[model samples]
Target: MRIVIFGGTGFVGLNLAEVLLARGHEVTLYDRAALPLSAQRSLADYGARLKAVQGDITDVDTIDALVAEGCDAIVLGAAVTAGEDLERVSPARVLEINVMAQIPILQAAIRHGVRRVVNLSSASAYGAAGQRHQILDEETPCDPVSFYAISKFTSERSAARHAELFGGDFLSVRLSAVFGPWERPGSVRDTPSLQFQILAAFARGEPALLPAPGIKDWTYAPDAAEAVAVLIEAERPRHRLYNISSGAAWSALQWGEAFAALHPGLECRLAEPDEKTFIKLHGGDRAPLSVTRMADEFGWRARFGCAESAAAMSAWWMQHKEWI
Candidate 1:
């Protein structure tokens, strides 16, 4: 399969590219930013299997031309993720990137020979639907709180509508807290993961400053990538909106403790957030994402827990030292 991923230089796209390349797929990564030097070094082993191409996603011609290159499937991983800072500074840009850009991207995919189209959505779309502790399934109502969430929800519906009218297989996957290799603080996605923070603190010999009891269903990047690969390769998928997550809940303290255990005296613990600083976990404890649908239908499940995932990331960071 030859796949062209928009925003392929970004965090999730990089991870997904590696997964597709490992599975013997040719990947053309189109992104606004060039692949970071660190990523180039890390993925050098893949050689010709992966190639990063820079282009403007909002341009329909660029999208059409890329798809015309003969792609098996197209994954729209391009978007401005959840971030208050981004919303405050450039709310309209968020919509322009996440929602408006989808129009041409989707049109080009169907216009070309691309079979399956995957739009990366976010669980933050749940918003107030996640106010309580209950696990959210595919059918859960999404009440977007922030601009990012709003764009994600709207994009999912909009793409589905387009697919209905144009006739094609389109999917919107609501991803949980995804973090691991290739995931760094970026302008498109600035939210830092608790695991990465802890690891960084250990490396710097500093105490990790975390929001108290930050808990959510965190999915490792490789696991999320595998689930995506499965969906892309599936001959027949019954649903359009699917949630890809670790399928289990974990806390900031747990990950901090796990890292501390591996490297003693890291002082991994939570710190109360003042008005200016914090990690927001307003969804409360154990806000698990119900992966039963993915498991039951596609026979897919997340393989790493918080501890194991943190350890794996630690090894990766050791090899790719410049990422942290």
Candidate 2:
């Protein structure tokens, strides 16, 4: 299969590219940012199977030309992960990139007779509803509050509507808090994951100070990418929307401690009273997302938990500490 991933230079895109390339598929990575040297060195073993193209996502001509060439599948991973600060500074930019830009891409996919289109959404789409509900499923109502959340929810609806009207195979997966290999600070992504923050502190030879026990269903990036790959290749998906998550909540502080155990002389603990901390949690803890739909349909479940992900990330960090 030949697949194209928008925002391919970003964290999740790179992980998905590696997964697909390892499965003996051709992959083209389309992104605004050039591929990082670190990624180039790591992906060198794949040879010509991987191609990275730098382009503006909003440029209809470029996107159309690329899709027109040929593609077996398309994964919409481009997004502006804005927080309140960015939302106030540039709200329209968020909408333009996260929502409006998707229209032309989907249109091109439809025109070119693409097989499958997978829209990468976030659990942030759940918004306040995530906090209110004890368990968030596909049927749960969403009251998205942040600009990022609103754009994600809007993108999902738009993709579904396009598929319904045009008879295209479009599916959206709402991913839980994703943190693992390839996650780094970038222009579009304002908030780094808690695990990233903790590991960054470790890289700097400092104690990881936590504001709180940041607990949520933190999905490892590789695991999340594999699940999205499943949806892209599924012959007949039972549902249009599905939740991808670890399906269990655990404290990121615990993960830090686990990593600390692997490396001696590193401190991972809570901040003292009245002490300032650099670590930033995404938001207050919310209910974990239910993976029942994915499990039932595809026999998929996240393999990494708090401890396992910690160990895996520790090994990755040892090799790619410069990425921090």
Residue-level lDDT tens digits of model 2 in 45-163: 98998999999999999999999999999999999988777888899999999999999999999999999999999999999998799999999999898999999999999999999
- Model 2 whole-model lDDT (C-alpha atoms): 0.93
Top-scoring candidate (TM-score): 2
Clashing pairs in 2: none
Q: Kindly give the number of clashing pairs for every candidate.
A: 0, 0
Give lDDT tens digits, candidate 1, residues 38-148. Answer: 878777888988888898888778778778888889998999875788789899999999999988888887788579999999888887778764889988877788898
Off by over 4 Å in 2: none
TM values, all candidates: 0.94, 0.99
Q: What lDDT would each prediction earn against the true structure?
A: 0.83, 0.93
Which regions of candidate 1 are displaced past 4 Å?
A: 272-286
